[model samples]
Target: MDRKTKIALGGGCHWCTEAVFQSLKGVNKVEQGYVASHGINSNFSEAVIVHFQPEKISLKTLIEVHLLTHKSTSNHSMRIKYRSAIYTFSEVQQKEALSLLDEFKSKSDSNIITQVYPFSAFEPSRNEIQNYYRQNPEKPFCKQFINPKLQLLLQHFSNYVNEDNIKHTDQK
Candidate 1:
């Protein structure tokens, strides 16, 4: 098994995507960063570098998790920079991604606008953003934005949470 471990992603903003994926069961860590954003440079867009155990989570499952996260909060249009996306690192990921779009198109009644960027570059986000929601849970961004998204995460991805650090999203 190839067991690819990381996927670069940017969904509107990192805080929301990070908050959600950071709680997934197989995911080891979700690092905030940027991917191509300049057209072919979609990798330049803000992203979350997800580290996971491929043994536990298939690439398809990761993509599904991403799409689910996107669907949950997409009503507010926070999925672009805050929008949901999965940046592909391989041809398999690419094909699987295209398959996902096709699957979503057939299953849903709404038009979806998301970026599927090929690998390019990833500049780790600033230290302040490393865990913006956790460190400043009382801040406006956390209270207004991150928290609302967290509500979505809790409602949907609760199984991924570790009771000991359920609020790690606010602390890290």
Candidate 2:
């Protein structure tokens, strides 16, 4: 078996990001958390720390999935709290993330605005917010915002999804 690795990602609400990544086949764990931001005031962005097997899925693939599942380009009108970002724990991760961004930039029309920063700290979200979608599937926000992302993953990345993580009845 391959050793697992962890990466912290912030694309949007932690609840949404957590639910999407938790379904991936190689992902052993997805913890919702807050990562220190580059902005003033020492605020934190909602993020997820994902533990996955690199042998089963490459970091590049994970980065692709992340960009696809959330809006990486910033919208000036939207709050900066949920801006897309990759918080790297090492120089290798930072390099890899930049390479992916370059690759993505070359293939797309719009710019990839996802930020890459050295990880400072990760504060796990409260219990009520963990495993949110599974526990509150019927919540309006989950049905409205999260279900579509889940369906997109199911359709485009079926091979990466864990069987047990396929909880959407409509997809089944």
Please give, for residues 24-64, the per-residue lDDT of candidate 1 as tens digits.
Answer: 67788888877664463443556788988888766666665
> Which clashing pairs does model 2 show?
none
Q: Write the per-residue lDDT of candidate 2 for residues 50-155, one digit (tens) a residue.
A: 9989999889888888988888766655535775888888899899888887898789888878877878888998898789988988888988888888888878
**Among these predicted structures, which one has the highest TM-score?**
2
| Model 2: CA > 4 A from native | 37-42
TM-score of each: 0.77, 0.91
Candidate 1, run of 10 with poorest lDDT: 163-172
Error of 1 at 66 (Å): 2.7
Q: Cα lDDT of all candidates, in order? A: 0.65, 0.82
